[model samples]
Target: MISVVIPTLGTREKELIRLFQSLSSQTLQDFEAIVVSQDNHDKVKELLAPYSFPIQHIKLDQKGLSLSRNVGIKYIKGNIVTFSDDDCWYKSDAFEKVQSYFDQHSTGIACFQIYDPEKAVYYKEYLKDPREKVGFLELFRKSSIEIFINLSVVDKEKVTFDEDFGLGAKYPSGEENIFLYTMHQEGYKASYVPEVVVYHAKPSLDTRLNNKAFASKGPMFKRIFNTPIGIALLTLLFLKKLNHLEKPIPFYLNSLGEMFRYKKSRKR
Candidate 1:
């Protein structure tokens, strides 16, 4: 069975309804959804009541996306696990495709394409040659919503989302990257299926430009790998933003400084 775990702040009732509605329309119906919310359960309870499939609405006072996902992971009862956000929903054949891929590659993590209604293309490079089976590095080109993990592999590896990263945490992103990287490091195979399984509504440009989102990368790299990786990442980030920002150099410097600070805190 495939288990869809969603970590939500319970604020997007309209989006949640749309997500559930999409799930209800999936061609494959052998999945369960675990919705982890930080807000009162009553609000979501009413919204979820209309679904035909099984859904477990879990509420917690804690507010980190990773924390909520970790909590949902503890209660997962399916052999395969996939994550979704409140604003995203699956294609009708998505769960079906996921099951098909996993059936063929029982030991591999399956990744598919995500369509953004607002954007002409999302992750264009990664989207190309969807039939290609990629390694740890290639998986970085995708997001958590685009992947379906084999729960047996994860359980054996004893891996969970890092509480320090992701939405609602100090670091607003990179949890998915770190998670897939860890999986690859552990010798798990990652398969890229040339299929669009999900769709994400575009986030605002302000959210994308939020310094907190990029700031976490420095510390995350330092803590997970080393200072060299952190430095390299910061440098690469600078080059990536070289043409777009007015003061990319200062931003990179500040990121490196934050990395050093985080590294120091780790030693203490």
Candidate 2:
């Protein structure tokens, strides 16, 4: 069975409904949806009841996405675990394809394409051969919606999301990238499949670099890579995405500053 874990803030009621509707429409029905709610728990439970497949609603008092995901992981019973965002919905054949791929390939991690309905494009600008082995740099391009993991592999390695990162934490992003990195470090093999599995109708703001979100990258860099590597990566990111940021100069300086500050705090 495939266990689909979704961590939500209960804010996207409309999108959440859409997501579940898609789940109900899936060609494969051997999956359960675990909705980890951080707010409006009761309402979320009520909202999820109408879905066709088996559903589980877990309430969380905390706000961090990583924390919510960790909570969902504890309750998962399926051998294969998948993650989906509250705002994203899967294609009808997604789960079927994922299950088929894992059955054929002996990989621990499997990634599919994440398409943006608004942009009318898949997230990966460059496509490799389908079912190609993906390592460090390639894995970074993935998001939660595009990936599935064999729980047995990750459980053996004791891998979980980093609570210090992700939405609603001090760091506002890079949790998925780091999680995949951790899995790789723990000796898991990840493969990329060029199939459209999920759709991301992202907000316009999601494309831009704001102060708080950009600043989080400094610490993210330090945590996932080394501090020196983090600084270099952050610098390159800032340079390449300068036009996407409102206050490019100030944001770059503050981001580097925050990285150092986060490092210092860890020592205390």
Candidate 3:
């Protein structure tokens, strides 16, 4: 069975409704939904009450995407685990495909693609063919919604997102990168399937630049690597993002400064 963990801030009622509508039509009924909310517990309960599928709701006073996910992990009732963004919905056969992949392959974690229904295209350019291993750099761009973990193959206890990063946390992004990189470092094999299983709207450029999204990547590189290669990777990244940013110098400097600060924090 597939266990889907969805973290929400009690906002996005319309989006969550659309998401549940998608899940309600899923061809695979073996999956369960776990909704972890920071607020509006009563609202979430009332909203999900109509859905016939088994659903679990956990209320929390604190907020942070990573922390909510970590808490949801403890309540998982299935061997396969996946995180779902409250605003995103899935294709009808998404769970079926995921379950089939885990059954046929030995990969501990599998990453798939997301499609933008309004745009009529994949969210981004993904691999054209199947990949046996997702590299460090590729994992940086991978979204959490695209990832699925088979607990029977991975060490379930060690699979967690860092609390310091992600949507509501201090740095406000890159927690997924740290999560996947740590999984790879722990000897778990990851594979990418060139298939679109989820649907989400394409984000605007303004949202992409919000909450120090680019600035946090530098510190994330540090968390992924212990050696000087982290610096080398940051230089490569600077070159890539520089071509599009209106102010590349500040972006680069912010990344570099944040990385150094993160490194210092690790020491004390």
Top model number, lDDT: 3
Separate clash counts for every candidate:
0, 0, 0
Model 3 scores a TM of 0.93
Across 34-109, the per-residue lDDT of candidate 2 in tens digits comes to: 9999999877988887876998889888898888888898888788988788999988998999889888888888
Q: What is the lDDT of residue 182 in candidate 2?
A: 84
lDDT (10s digit) by residue, model 1, range 1-268: 9999998887898899889999999999999999998986788888888887988889898898888888897777899988888899888999898888777775658888888866866534455575545865576677898888887665633557877778897778888888887777777778788888898866654456456666776887786679988798768876886665445666666677778887323311
Computed on alpha carbons, the lDDT of every model, listed in order, comes to 0.79, 0.83, 0.86
What's the best-to-worst order under lDDT? 3, 2, 1
- Ten residues in sequence with the least summed lDDT for candidate 2: 259-268
- TM-scores for the candidates: 0.91, 0.93, 0.93
Whichever of 1 and 3 has more lDDT, that candidate is: 3
Model 3, position 51: C-alpha lDDT score: 99
- For model 2, name the residue pairs that clash: none
Better of 1 and 3 by TM-score: 3
